[model samples]
Target: MARETWGTRIGFILAAVGSAIGLGNIWRFPFQVSQEGGAAFMVMYLAFIILIGFPAMLAEFVVGRKTELNTVGAIRDFAGGYWQYLGGLFVFIGFVILSYYSVIGGWVLRYILGSVTGGYAATESAAAYFGMVATGTDTLIAHAVFMLLVIGIVALGIQQGIELGVKVMVPAILAIFGILAVYAFTLPGAGEAYAYYLSPDIGYIMQNWQSLVPAAAGQGFFTLSLGMGVMITYASYLGDDKNLGIDGISIVVLNTSVSILTGLVVFPILFSAGVDPATSGPGAIFVSIAEAVLDLPFGRVVGLLFFLTVAIAALSSAISLIEVVVSYAIDEFGMDRVKATVIAGVAIFILGVPVTMNTVFINLYDILAAQILLVLGGVLLMVLVSWLHAGEAIEELEQGIGDLGSIGSLWIWMVRVPVILVLLVSLYLGVTGYIDFLTGAFAEYLGTL
Candidate 1:
């Protein structure tokens, strides 16, 4: 059997953009901006994206295109020996991410259904409605439905399945969100909301630079879908003719644009309805946005569109997460694509069961995958490229990017030193934060006992 290559360059670019633009952009990025001094955080984040994110992305691309294999096989072929296990770890991180990620996808699906049925409109408290839906039988049914959708698409094989799916999904997501952004501008407090979102608070940033920098760096990596083998797997299908540097920039730009657009839609609606963005927390979308929609003309229709946007974004990303593992199974074990996708999907769905049943386990898994494992995976990948295979890595990069010049030397040095240092700091912060959370939770449990 021959390995699959993407049918067109546009197909490959859209698929990568689809993977990058997801729940992280819509749900996580806006909240981070709100908490991290708005425009100041945005500035720092863009800097990291250029300096750290792009180089790290290119390194993954080099590994994938050079070897033309899935994460484990790519490392095994490129470096051989014990280093291959590191690639295996990257694949496992993707699996863990998809496990909890699908659960959230289920929540988004339920919201779309509720929007159509006026379930959220009838509720006296949107928060209470979310609480009921987030666990138990409702969650399980939604999770199953979401995972089946992912499996069906992936089972169709690469160009027919993943490529075709994102081609439709990416355009629809943009059109829908574009409509929402235009609608948000007509709301009563649009100007104020824009100012609040776009204005820089130099004082706050100066005071909080220590915490804000790491948060921005981590968010930059997470938003691009790096460190979890998604990019590596996607790039493995590419031909040597493609310019990886150009495609990488395009992915980052599209992903960042969507993130900003989400804030345009979210903050304006919240302000027009007199909801305080600060107090909304993670409930900003479910509670605040849901309630705000009910008071507007044609609210149900708009609510339906909003949740539909979320559903599309979540699905686009979920496909990539599942693909990382599926590709690995096909390459490493020579499993058939359909069989690999089904087995992987079912296993991931089963893994999500405990998360859906208990919120504590969900939080723990989220911290491990997002904060800890992702940073560790990224750090190891950079080390492999910079230390173990610098000569080969540079050669691979040059195949797509052409001449090195001074820029190439700068790229190599940045990845080897500054990028690795930033990731190490992120790993330390993630570990300490997780430890503190666990210690506090354990203390509470002991008191109850």
Candidate 2:
């Protein structure tokens, strides 16, 4: 079967960026930067992006473009039977990720409605708001509804599913975020938030070096939708005419900018409301930022805008993840888009059952995603690009990027050696207990009592 292709280069870039600029950027970056020390981590993270993330991304791109294959096929062609399983593994992880991911997107959708109805405005307490979000049967139902919307979009095929979806969603996400940041900066404690985010803390950096290094790198790769087959899948539709390196750099810049901007908005609200940085947990934005919103001079408008923007950002990524599974299914198996989407949706809904039933599922998912899928996937990609298609990779990277092409050699080395070592070290830290895995504040509060 001939593979489907994206109609326009811009469409492909937008779709790829949609997958990259997601919950990782907005949902996690704030709490992470707040705990890890802001600008220090950001600086290291940018270095990782250029040194490791960009190269891994191009590795995925070359495999996709040369083979015109999805994650599964791309691996099979290069590495034969042994490695193809790894690629299938990536596709499966993307599927597993989308399931629970959309559930969080459901939280965003719920909050968007809450904002419109002023439900969030009446709440004074973070715990109460977070409680209202969780432990409610309604939340699960909302997740189901959100999943169906994602399925519907994926059923539309590329031009409609990914292309048009991102086109509208990306602009909306940026516009709302820009407005929210402006309003946030005007808040009384806004400068404090900026300091909290921008000021370097060498003590924190040194103490958390082992733990934070892996995290920053993982997020750098994950934030840009690299390491996973999502980038490979998106770039398969990429034409040889455009400069892949330039396009990759643009996406990385845009994704990183949004992540930083989200931190600018979130931490200020957090600092302004005097929320405990250590305790914000997985739902920190909802808790800390929600509390921050209620304290604003125009609290209603601010909270409404904040939650709605999060919803849009979350939805855009969810749609792209769904499309990754949907596209591979239709193209590889010769199924119709609708049949592919429905099966993919149903399978994911079942997989997400763990996320709904177990609180530990969230941690398990995050840990496994980083250690197993993300690290392993990235390592495999580097090997394929540098070892398997070394010559072609050099040529493709040089084609569009001009003088910048020379850095391509260094990128390959970093992605192949340093990147894997860092990921392995981080995975070991989690497994061996070099540091405690403290994600929320409840434990500290409990200790006080």
Best by lDDT: 1
TM-score of each: 0.96, 0.92
Model 2's alpha-carbon lDDT is 0.74
Question: What C-alpha lDDT does candidate 1 achieve relative to the native structure?
Answer: 0.85
Note the Cα lDDT for every prediction shown.
0.85, 0.74
Query: What are the runs in model 2 whose C-alpha is more than 4 Å off?
Result: 398-408, 430-449
Cα lDDT tens digits for candidate 2, 165-218: 888888888888998888778777788878767777778777778767777766
* lDDT (Cα, tens digit) per residue for candidate 1, span 29-101: 7777776777778777787888889999999998999999999999899889898988888888878878887
Q: Specify the poorest-scoring 10-residue window by lDDT in model 1.
A: 277-286
What C-alpha lDDT, on a 0 to 100 scale, does residue 401 get in candidate 2? 57
